[model samples]
Target: EQVKVSKQNFLLGRGERLTDDIVIKGGGGPKEPPYTFGEARRRLSPMVSETSSRIDELPQAACPGDEAVISLTINPEYVAKSFFPHELMRDVGIEVIGSRPKKTVPEKRSRGREPSEVFTTELFARGRRAAIRNWSQQLPDWRSDRGSANALISIEEISAPVPHAKIKGSLPEQGRMALETVLHASELEFSMIQAFAAYLESQGIEADLGHSFFAKGLCFLELDAPVERADDIALFTGVRTLRQMPSLRILRPTVRSADIPTTDLELPTEGPVSEDVRVAIFDGGVPENHALTQWTSRLELPGMLPATEGFLSHGVGVTSAALFGHIDTKVPLPRPYANIDHYRVLDEAPGQDPHKLYEILGRIEGVLSSQEYDFINLSLGPCLPIEDDDVHAWTAVLDDRLSRVSTLAMIAVGNGGEGDSILGLDRVQVPSDCVNALAIGACDTPGKDWQRAPYSSKGPGRSPGLVKPDLVDFGGEFSRPFVVVAPDATPSLTTTGGTSFAAPSVLRLGTGIRAHFGSNLNHLAIRTLLVHTCEEGDQDHKENHKEIGWGRVARSLDDIILCDDDTVRVVYQGEISPAKYIRAAIPVPADPMSGMVTIKATICYKTQTDPHHPGNYTQAGLEVTFRPNDSKYSRNNQVHPNSASFFGSSLPGATEDELRRDAWKWENCLHAVQRKRGSSLINPCFDIHYNARLEGRNFAPPESLSYAMVVSIHAKGVADLYDQVVRQYATQIEPLRPVLEMPIRT
Candidate 1:
């Protein structure tokens, strides 16, 4: 057979870090303000008094000396650590243990205000109850005495953790629950929590830390106690949120669907797949001796894991999807993209086990801590939906683990879109909110006519990670079910429909991309490329971002890597020091061109997280500024050039929320396109500045961050643009070619 040539996009490191400054300089900025001391005291005194009074009438009584959690809402502007009310808290003898960013809609909207514009992240402090009553009685005078320290004037409100912070709905008087305690990991705090647990044990209530994990500086643990007891536990200064653990609430564990017609499918011919690529599926246990054995192996824990029929079946289907994709009944089954190791993380009583969330995560974490994989797909997570004011243990631990290694994880956004949206039950589930991983949602079908599957979760995920279900792929629908290998010993197929299958299907594609492009394209670059070449079709103009996100993944590998005649795509993979700026120039033809040109770019990076700060979850952010012409200067600022809209601009006629500091600026996956006349372009480039924060406040020193960018330029009537770019930047950039045979599927 004649070998066909392939045109490949290239990588570049043309931008270099700064070595020396032409001139020495120092800089400072004017500070943003909050409320004045007197007004703030006047507004907060009543709240404190009411809370002080209310605390006495609670299910649990708080002795003046007993530790209690009091929430102090602060002015939005004073969120930085420097602006924290530390001095005042010390004066009042109350220690501020922890804080999370919050956004509240002003009761009254101004004439031009949208919710996003009207709300910026405000700080809600967890204060250890100390002299709060005395402080309330003389609130106005104490802050005044400190004069400059009255920065506590930022206090907007004081209350017992608000009603919304607690577990919602009713639960049996004695039921199993999970308690999230606000502890910042100190010997003193740990002792307090241990003592509380001991007290609970004395009462015969179970408060085990065996399966516990920390989130947002809070410890979440399994507890078996009465509803009244749960309420009393909330009184402790360390506890923040509580939830009723569901019984047998397994998600996607049952592969429910219409039975498929008998079909013949062949397993991939056993041979060495690209040794460079590694993939894994963290799900229920797959059936023993399944036909997928050629390319799939189970990572069994120390002992034999117990499994139910449903779990095994669901596991087989999920692993099958990762290996074979939505099996095509029309043609012969294709070879597996890359050999995958399936970890039987979930066993027989996962859903029935209240502490299963932690156990499952522990298993997954243990595997990640040892073996490394290039790609991983998780089709299951907690049945609970994500919350704005909180971070779940599963999400925090997984995100932290992923950040330390070079791995691309895909999470099913969940199959709860049909749930009640008004109550947010229909939103993306926990762990998928992870800023470091791709949260996959299912579209109804595999064709261009597809829409988000009715059961696939939706999302306007929490800000800073607003875009959710990173990309959609065909999971399956009742009308058109997804076919996968069954749990039967012999090669067989079954029908299913859910986001569980959608996630691995996409992972299969990623591994295939890695197999084709070789190691030159790391996981981050592959992520950037997948998101960059997304096909939105009519969705490009839809207001369904909350549902479809960046739109569906291109089904075929060719669509993603192959470029059009007038288009040229380049990938930038590098690291930048914290608080420094780097330029990523948009590749274009050498000569001045005519007609209109469109530039589409997607930038992706992983961040070390602060689970304690849901409002400021990601510790790193990139402030990308697009400057189209080097010679043009803004009239207001002479030193820097003029800038134009790129990633952060709102769509036409869109009433986008004005988030405090613009949440989009910190989003990990940023995709946007702009069309302009070719003549206006003159060395256009994006200036990216990395911003670092810790515990919702600036840090003294920051670490370097890794980032990948996929930018493509398409010029009308410029048939030779790709050739021109390749020739002009010959020394700087080269094509990313296949290191092995490219798989062919028709």
Candidate 2:
């Protein structure tokens, strides 16, 4: 058979071998291996020299000291190159501040042409004038290295900052506009707030600085101005100034309360509180006199004011749901098993000042770092929707804290899913987009009829596309909302619906899992178990995925961990090192009548991150593969016989680069496959391979990265499959049994 290979394939480092039984109908012919491989290699050898000469001959320009930021378009071949591209920047005194995948538009199909792929990264360098000038002169050499070694495609100066539409749109007609701006930490010495204020004054625009945030090398500044002068202020502080400062990143509108429908509700008084699980709820202050008050230990954190009547309902309802499963009086339930600690972070008023809300980041950090709690439930978030290109300060802070702690936090995905706004679909609000936190969305009801609530947030998440609403829970439908305690002192019940209620329901489930597994179980293991047991309904449909995530979580911990006859579940909890592989073998039944075998697995891990680099946020990623131990299922015969690697390449004809570009680098990943029983395997054993990689800078490849893997095998019409496997490989396989803890009898 004749094989045709393109020059681009040679450039991408994929043309080294020609596999069996394939006909490539183009340039190369079979029986000419030396000629085919030799010709391509010869053509690729002179690329560097040619590129270097061309770069040196091109025009040169001196870069200003203030405008030291440059964006590099890396060649797609950079990953396969011998040298890391970032090292080139370092040699020239350039600092690779942050990087994100460059967005590409698919080209229209044309005859005899393949789509092109380009990788772009941004670099920032700061030094004295002489150093800046010297580095600028080395541009040609940098370009030469990039072109020859396939490290970079092009280098260009980043001259301006982009204006945020939300900031401009939120400006008032006459009064001053309130703006929240995040400046790069490197530029803080410039005193950006003062510079901007002075600039505004020169334009006869009065400006007030309200708050400043300093964390993770970020400087958040709050500015207020009259509505009429807002546009002028925006113009003066726009892209041109960003070019000069190189550190100011984004300017957004401060969030304010929007009218949401609310009705008062009475607290549930039927359940007794057990001290088995400890959870902290951060929101408005909880009233000490509520019906569930005896079950909770209330503490108002310093800097938080007392809760008022208007702000009491939200906190009361969320706390009630977290402590007691559901607020409906008709649903009979046992005494609550989880203890509660309520921390008031929000003010008692109906609405919060945006500046004050921004200040809450520090308070949250303090509580998360110092407080002792097994689980944290956050029913609050900003009104602003998360941006694909930017990681909000709130989300970054929360993710950083969660990664460092053993405890897991659950955040509401927000109730902004209603209306015609694009944010209503596939745009989970900030903090909820925190990749480390389990962001919960609202389901319309409980049990089999559960659907995504109209007011529940949806998400493909921000860039890198971490699927949001990791799990959904009953938050109540429009017509059948969850009942809650009213704001008034009297005992009364009101119906309401939002993701705020849904988060606690999931937290309640986490508490149960914690109770069974004990506090020793890592958060990743618990997260894996919860996602492993999620019930998928209409999830195969692509649209429903963004709306419901992995689908609604199981109601009980036993339902999640325990397996019935004919099904075997295995759980692996361990850590993986960079560039190393962890393998697990599963013993399969050898019976011809083993029936259909279905395999489902969930992998969850926590990763360190460069919060400033929204484009390349997560620092570590897990690549997983599941396949039969049989050697016959080689790469040539099967599309993805090697299992679903980090890029999910098990599907037919998917290329490595294609999968790598689409893989989710977030902390949580899930994949499942089902196959009918057949006699193709010589060995009835299956293997799982886990590989870990350190994807960004400043991340010390941990000696071992902790992770959890849950695998379940089910057979149809084969009642003895579980017994057969357990008996055959008793030492290698073990059933996942819930640790039963007896309830205290009252």
Q: Show model 2 residue runs off by greater than 4 Å.
A: 1-67, 73-84, 100-175, 186-210, 214-217, 225-276, 348-352, 421-426, 485-493, 590-593, 633-662, 665-667, 676-700, 732-746
The residue-by-residue lDDT of candidate 2 on 470-530, one tens digit each, is: 8898887656667655544665556666788789888888887676556445577777777
Clash statistics: count for each candidate? 7, 20
TM-score of candidate 1 relative to the true fold: 0.89
- Candidate 1's displacement at residue 68, Å, is 4.0
Candidate 1, overall lDDT?
A: 0.72
Task: Give the whole-model CA lDDT for all candidates, comma-separated.
Answer: 0.72, 0.56
The best candidate by lDDT is 1
